[model samples]
Target chain A: MTGIFFDAVTLSFGKRKIFDNVTLKFDCRKIFGVTGANGSGKSTLLKLAGKILHPDSGTVNFPDNAQIAALSPEMKIYDALTAVENLKFFARLRGKILSDEKIFELGRRTGLDMKTFGNERTENFSTGMRQRLKFAILLAVDADIWLLDEPTANLDDTGRENFFAEIQAAKSEKIILLATNDVAEAQICDEIIRLPM
Target chain B: MKLFGSRCDCVLAIVRKDFLLNLRRRATFAAMMMFALTTVASLSLSTGGAILDEKFLAAILWVVIFFAATAGLSGTFDDEAQAGTLSTLKLYGDAQAILFGKMFVSMLSLLALTIFILPIFCVLFDVNVEKIFLLLATILFGLIGLAAAGTLTAALTTSAKIKGGLFAILLFPVTLPIFLPAIRLTEISFTSAQVDSSLLVVIGAFDTILILASSILYDYL
Candidate 1:
């Protein structure tokens, strides 16, 4: 009841069946790795859990008041807004007003120095910087469920260390789903759900 | 009461973010302003000192407003989609709040355009407005209707391959109800100085229906 449940979930894209009669329950407070090859429904599974996509049949259930946040490569930050502004705007959307100090703390947790680059518009940011900002946004929302697809794709070595540390720190009370193909990343998960190609 | 408060916060946040983006980009507002100014100036020059009839003038005014609204407002959702932020909004923001916030921004843009163009239109065309209050009311209602219709059309077409073209095509047909009544009301204001209560009611009703429909349809999209 407190975590995500998929009951007889069958989802298809046109004629190709992505999830065929799949039933899985994610009810733990540890990080779960959804590992699969390219085009193997890794991201699709996370999206289904996030309710961004609906199953063609069956049901995916989570608590009614559970807050969910997703970070995918397809997601983007506002180009014209500064990094701090972006974090504040996203937090506000979820009815939370984030102070500058809180935003700075989130930034620091993601290996980003708010005092240095917080005021610059994100359009000028590099790929790694944008990825770090996305992580900061993920932290700012402070959701109960986190659906992170390819979470470390564009992060540098330092950024990855910071990300893993944060994940390890927050794994006690949150259900974190990490969809990745990297063996090292998958090793960090307590349970690995491998999707068949 | 708590739900209502949260909804208001979401709406306000969306409006604030959009306004800031528009201010920074300056593309949509600039395009709308340029389209309105160019059309009005061209019509004024082409008239060649001839005293245009009130009905024709009213028609011209509405035509300018209509096309300008189309040119600028159709990108409301297209911009978000193109920038890859539409999904983010869908994930975090409430459906009704997003619809209302975008509609409110469109309304503000149209109101600003009307203020900028009305005096120039009146002076260049040498048209004496008999009822200023009625004219403003008619314009206000017409713009609200336009904003509502445009916002819905933008949302409906955000996923289209040719979003801008589809937006214009769909908007014209969908907004006919608002345009016809609005044009008539403007003419009444200009010529007879008599208000058509029924026409105002029609436009208001259209606005309400469009806003409600958009709020419902947005979640599915």
Candidate 2:
């Protein structure tokens, strides 16, 4: 799909121009970090790339019928599901049955434990834990593009490390686009693009 | 190589996911079941005498279906909208398939609920429900139309703060055209056991139009 390319992509909501003729490209299978001020459009850029919202102008080159794995800020993990249950739900969406062995492997990769919390419903898991679980689903799905928005928003130091590790392992061949407010998060990125809020 | 669209596999996947959600989430299914049962019981008990009048009986049946439709839609989209799965869904399949898929399950549930409670309705009202085949057909056609119309309106206004209320309001006017014949055909067949070919034609025509329009407008919705 041209390795995640944007040609003069511009998005304007009302009088404010969220993005203006912003043209950029990233090679496929690279970890890219997108950083911006409070309203500079880091998240908007991700949504545009994810095809959730169209740019007001210009075309975004993307794989046709790409199987996407996204961790949006607005994502709400089923409070009633354990980390395993949540992963299985997304896995099935891609037409893959969730095997027990596969789910265990995902939990391990994302630093989630099923022994104590796997059997339990996710309703009790902390917000940071929910964040970790969502990223875990992204890893399990193994989609062509990974659009992560603030994946480490609520995570503690260890969770942050695990989040990056999961993204790195998952990006061996998949395109990874991360939008974050954390500068440390950008350090691991192959390319960093700063957007205005 | 069908990348997207309402193929059997895609629809089945959505239906399977929905049915699984219904089974896993006790509160949602329990709430729908209890509401269906209670509404049926109260109508049967409170209106037994009044329903002896054919017009009143027909009206009550429509009301029951209406409320049942509402109860079903409320829980059906809850998973996608409330679960924040809407964004993920956008990337997986054609929006039309997802729309029809959700509508199919809701309509299926409506059919099951209608059948489950119809016997009790027949006994409670003590009306000779004439033209049994036609009556069943009407429910099938009527609910499919309802599901299509409701599916479009629900997606259009799902972002609203009062989605259920907004959905009812948005649908009420759009579907007014169907009400007269739905009632007329039901009343005609039930009262006289005379099958009105014209009435079924009207309902069938309405069904086709509504389903087609809803399907076409879903991309916009």
Candidate 3:
């Protein structure tokens, strides 16, 4: 009741049935790795938990007051906004007022040189920089649930390390459903749920 | 305890973000202004020094505003969809906040376009607006109606394959209520200089209903 639960969930895209009568429950204070093949609905499962997608039948339920944050290839920050501005704007959306120092700290944790690029618009950022900006947003919102789909796709080695460390530090208090194919990433999860069972 | 966030703050944040993005890109505002100017200039030249009827001119004014709005404001949600920021907004933003925020931005853009074009239209056509205040009120209510309709259309068509075409198709019929009353009000402003309070009420009521309906329906979309 205090976590995410899927009850006999069935979802299909057109004629292809991706999920059929699947039930799973994820408790808090744990990092759950959702692993599967390319078409195995790893990301789809995370989307369901994040409430970005609804199952055609059955139900996906979570706490009423839970705040959800998602980082996926399909999620992007405003290209015209500066990194700091993006953080501030998103925080405001979640009713959180972030200070300049706190924002810079999030930037630092994500291995972004926010002091140098904070004022610069994100359209000029490189791919890895944009990914870091997304991570910064993920941290800024401070959500109860994090649905990360391929969270390390564009990060460099150091960026990946910082991401893991952040996830490890926050794992004790949040319900994080990480969808990834990386063996190393999956190994860190408290439990790994393989898709297409 | 407010778990998610304050709805009012979320709406304000969305409005601020959209305005900032528009300011930086200058796409929507610029497109609206360009279309308005081009249409007015074309009308001025095509008239060939002939005196146009006030009622016809009133129709032309609303037509120009309507099309320019269609061209510019139809992409309100498409911008988020294309940029892939829609999911994030859905994750953190309240549904009513998103709708109102977008509607506010659309109204502001239309207001700016009107302010920029009206002077030029009046000068080029050599038309003296006898009841300027009434004309302004009509434009204001008409714009609110247009913005409400346009924002809802954008949200509805954001997922369509042929978004532009569908948006125009749907927006035209949906906004006819606003346009009919707006055209009549404009004509009265120019000729009789009398308040057609009934038409004003119609446009105002339509705007309110559309906005309230959009707020309830946006969450589903």
lDDT of each: 0.88, 0.74, 0.88
Cα lDDT of model 3 by residue, A69-108, tens digit? 8888888888999999998998898888999899889989
**Which candidate, 1 or 2, would have the higher TM-score against the true structure?**
1
Q: How close is every model to the real structure, measured as TM-score? A: 0.97, 0.87, 0.97
lDDT by residue for model 3 (B93-183), tens? 8788889889998999899889999989888887778888889999999999889989999999998887647888998888899899898
Ranking by DockQ: 3, 1, 2
The residue ranges of model 3 lying beyond 4 angstroms of the native Cα positions read B1-5
Clashes of 3: 0
Question: Regarding DockQ, does 2 or 3 come out ahead?
Answer: 3
Deviating ranges (above 4 Å) for candidate 2: A156-158, B1-7, B24-51, B78-80, B91-94, B161-164
Q: In order, what are the TM-scores of chain A for the candidates?
A: 0.97, 0.92, 0.97
- Global fold similarity of model 2 (TM-score): 0.87
**Per-residue lDDT for B25-103 in model 1, tens only?**
9989989889999999999999897988878898899899988988889889888988999898878788888898899
